[model samples]
Target: MFYKYKCGNEIIRVFVWNDDFHNEVSVEDTKTQKSYDRTIREDENGKFFTWNRNTIYLNDWIKISMKELKEKIENGERITSDDLCQAIMTDGVENVRFIAPLNIRCGFGFFLNGNEFKDTLCKVEERWNREIKQNYKIVLIPVESDDSVANSADYYTEDFVSLIKCGNIKIAETQKLIHQEQSNEDYFEGVNDYFDGTMGV
Candidate 1:
């Protein structure tokens, strides 16, 4: 089995089942089905995706990890994300502690830290379901990286507990997409709709 990550213009499909140690990474382009002989270290250096110590590489935006942000303050550098660039320095922080990430999927790879952050809750009302059946996607605030590393970081994993909100999977939205062959006509038909056809979904 493998997982797909939208990095830059490539839909990196990392095949995790390969036991061949000769090549640490067995990756391929999802569209062309072409494979590459590479190592995780190479990918970490932009052969694919960089394995960063503190920044997160998202498809739309880049985010800085909390530890990296704190170091920026100590070194005195401009921040990347605009969320709390000035707020943290002006308002100041106290009693900072890292919490295991609340979100499992696209939430965050870095551990969540709270200095003055507070949690807010909203009741699951019947009104939402009346209009749309899907659950709402919650927005989160991640620390910004300093200007120095902002250019480098473009933007991963796991477990523990939950004391905040609860959710159940919507089986309807969990459908798997099966690949279908498309002819030259069907492929070029939507050229006008997409410029380079490299845009990530």
Candidate 2:
């Protein structure tokens, strides 16, 4: 399975598990197409070790069953997109937390970090509510299957626009559409449309 994340200007695409012989985790920068590989390590004692303490903890969090994850979410713990991505890799999509549209098929994808994306969605929803004063449903579409690590911005924007269009999320008034070029400093704001919304599942 694979997951995508937008961290600053870098689009991080993580291949959790693949048919590759090494069974290593492959992380790729969508923009540069540069990649790195990390694998679970074992110490001399025959005990498995994660890349580091943080990753070991992350792996533990990933091991939490979906039921537990939901409970944690209900208990007010924020699940980072990184956590979700790792969980999806470890547990598979069907077993991961969050809701997906019934129409979403096997290959459909979601943002890597659920909490961060949700916060962004909330911002868009608030903007719409303030401007339009009408409730609107936001739907997230999977990144196009053919989206490449190189030129991730294209597919990411396409998916974002598709979500808006698919849900009929329109601006209440014609305002200057600010287009900010992606940069290492603040890519999230650059992609902000001020008209996005969140999906129920």
Candidate 3:
């Protein structure tokens, strides 16, 4: 199942349900008015995934679509590691098991102008912990870079040790950092300590 969103000045679309499926569409430019396409696909074990043909601009205001917003909720097109894993397995040819690593990248920055990249790993991890068996070691791969989404020249970097790998260390650290960064004060002492507790880092 997939959803289409055309909110505000941006015409965003999401084709989710099965890992080999994803497409994010937006206008090329506010001035020129061209059409651009951004698509991302991957597998269950996190071995094989790719994002192809997407455009990005340095401008400020991100155009969003109201139609797209309504559709995402209606279709349940949120990105998750399980979604990636299912995509890999569902799309695999024959019995050819994809024996590669997993890359869990949260594209938090705006690939489209108005779209904010929200992280969904915390929820996905909880589900995976309960549902996924112990025979398989699911490596968490995070695409860490400015252009990890539509800007990478290659298939994008997939690191095995992410916040998931280190338990919730990164999460706690991120929370403290966010508070400090936003408030402009070192109010939280032992922030790193809290993160360390999660992973013994």
TM-score of each: 0.20, 0.24, 0.19
Measured over all alpha carbons after superposition, the RMSD of each candidate to the real structure, in angstroms, is 22.1, 20.7, 20.1
lDDT by residue for model 1 (24-139), tens: 54557556678754444433434233421222222222333344555554466643223222222122222122221222222243443333222221111123222111111212
- Give the poorly placed runs of model 1, Cα more than 4 Å off: 18-23, 42-201
lDDT of 2 by residue, 1-92 (tens): 44454434444455554233554666664556777776655554442223322233113222433344445545667644343334333444
Best by TM-score: 2
**CA-lDDT, candidates in order:** 0.30, 0.34, 0.31
User: Which parts of model 3 have CA positions greater than 4 angstroms off?
Assistant: 1-9, 21-125, 129-183, 187-201
Per-residue CA lDDT of model 3 for 21-130, tens digit only, reads: 33433333434455444443334433221223333221112232322322432465553333333332332212112112222234474434324332322111212432
lDDT of 3: 0.31
